[model samples]
Target: MNSMPKYLLMALALISLIACKTSQVSTTPSPAAGMFKVAILYPNGDDKTFDMDYYEKKHMPMVAGHLGSNLKFYEIDKGTAGRTPADKVPFVAIGYFYISDVAEYNKAIAQNRDAIIGDIKNYTNIQPVINISEIRQVVGNNTK
Candidate 1:
């Protein structure tokens, strides 16, 4: 048997093993459910004064501390390349919060309502577009 074929077989086996290990790790939500996701989207192409660094570093941590294990934050940057007749090139930011339920989500917001509002004011330099969503199902991971 050629050495090349032997090396190829070894690599294939290693890849398969890694894939199996990853698949074995579950990503399903835990039975003791206390999680939700919040998504925040910002306007497009304005580029006026949106301090993402401050929001991620200072504001998010503060909010997370207030909420504790009940919440998780996910942020996404959505900036388009150019402008168009339909306002194509928009600089957008999305933040997702994972909390327990609607009531808890509301409570968390209310608790940090002032700080949240202030952070938004400071970061965006303009009113931020806000949206709250309920997570019906998570495709992967079941742990926490």
Candidate 2:
């Protein structure tokens, strides 16, 4: 029996957690209901280092290229401060991509898993929390 690759397995696990939640915040209005969303959260800590420059400039573009047309779009959130001035930051950075199809995403991941997984070391050592979800609704200024 062939077991799933470690990276793919982890992605599947994270995707199952929030299959119906919105992770993107924008004025472009929601990209229709049931949109597949992938969110990667890099949890912050006392000794962690996340190279924002590399992530924003290099890694994400590589991801987008690999994701190709199935990737509707993506967003990145850089942590500035916590809930309050004295609190610790929850995450160093968060990367979210609105995928057009889950199956295609999986297929792409299967082919490029090594390249994607291997690039993590260039930016941060922290294991990111991945969430694959669906957009249920859009509230606030984003709603139609």
Candidate 3:
């Protein structure tokens, strides 16, 4: 019984990784001026596992709902490969959020922290590396 969740998690992870082909290129509109960026990177590890299906279908939507209007945009990226051919996939996945108000975002996160943190176990076991930054530049096609 205990193994069932683990098996499902593993299967979801494998399917996600396989579906995101490394050779493909994707583009998103450049962040608007002054937007704050929040990056949540789930580093890969020997024992770490992630269920992308749960994260994409359930967890992220829940978070967006919790965040409400403060969150302008968000994306969930499945790590396919590293920069070099020999390098390992650095992160299992990454969640990116573009927000308008830092204070409001913080407040929302604080209010929903328990529910958000509690759901982590359903999708992933790794601790994510989080970075909040100011969008400084935009150079690519500003289109989706």
Candidate 4:
């Protein structure tokens, strides 16, 4: 059997592509009205002890209970390495909290501040540097 001309075949293919369209999947990010807050605590001096096990098992649970609905999610990142593997981690550990509101976060924190502070001694000697940040989703071709 004889095939159509190359130009005609190409035109038909283009038309078929345009006609046979599929439903597009929504790639919208999850709805999160609240901001994300992170507090990174750096060790004050060389002589310090951080009890990771206790922090994960005890302290975080207490914080979560107090936080309640205000707390959307929480994470802990232990400083294991720096830019170079040989280099020491700048901070001892970092705490990330996705909160519904700043005021709620503060209130929860205020109510349990003493207990939280008290627990710190059980873990590490270093007083960490704290930082709060807003959560922003980067919407671009690179992001899904």
Q: Model 2 clash tally?
A: 0
Ranking by lDDT: 3, 2, 4, 1
Weakest ten-residue segment in model 4 by summed lDDT: 22-31
lDDT of 3 by residue, 1-144 (tens): 999999999999998888887747787645887899999999998999999999999999999898898888899899999999898999999999899888998999999999999999999999989999988776767798
**lDDT tens digits by residue: candidate 1, 65-141:** 77765665445564655466666655456666666666766787798898878767767765566666666654656
Instruction: Tell me the lDDT of model 1 at 3.
Output: 95
Give the worst 10-residue stretch by lDDT in candidate 2: 20-29
lDDT of 2 at 98: 91
**Clash total of candidate 1:** 15
RMSD of each: 8.9, 20.4, 17.1, 10.0
Taken over the whole model, the C-alpha lDDT of each candidate is 0.68, 0.88, 0.91, 0.76
lDDT score for candidate 3 against the true structure: 0.91
Which residue pairs clash in candidate 2? none
* Position 6, candidate 1: lDDT: 93
User: What value does the lDDT take at residue 132 in candidate 4?
Assistant: 76
Query: How many residue pairs clash in each candidate at the backbone level?
Result: 15, 0, 0, 0
Cα lDDT of model 4 by residue, 14-110, tens digit = 8888767644465643425346675757553478788889888998888888989877777888887777988778777877777768888888889
Cα error, residue 21 of model 2, in Å, equals 38
Candidate ranking (TM-score, best to worst) = 3, 2, 4, 1
Per-model TM-score versus the true fold: 0.59, 0.75, 0.76, 0.69
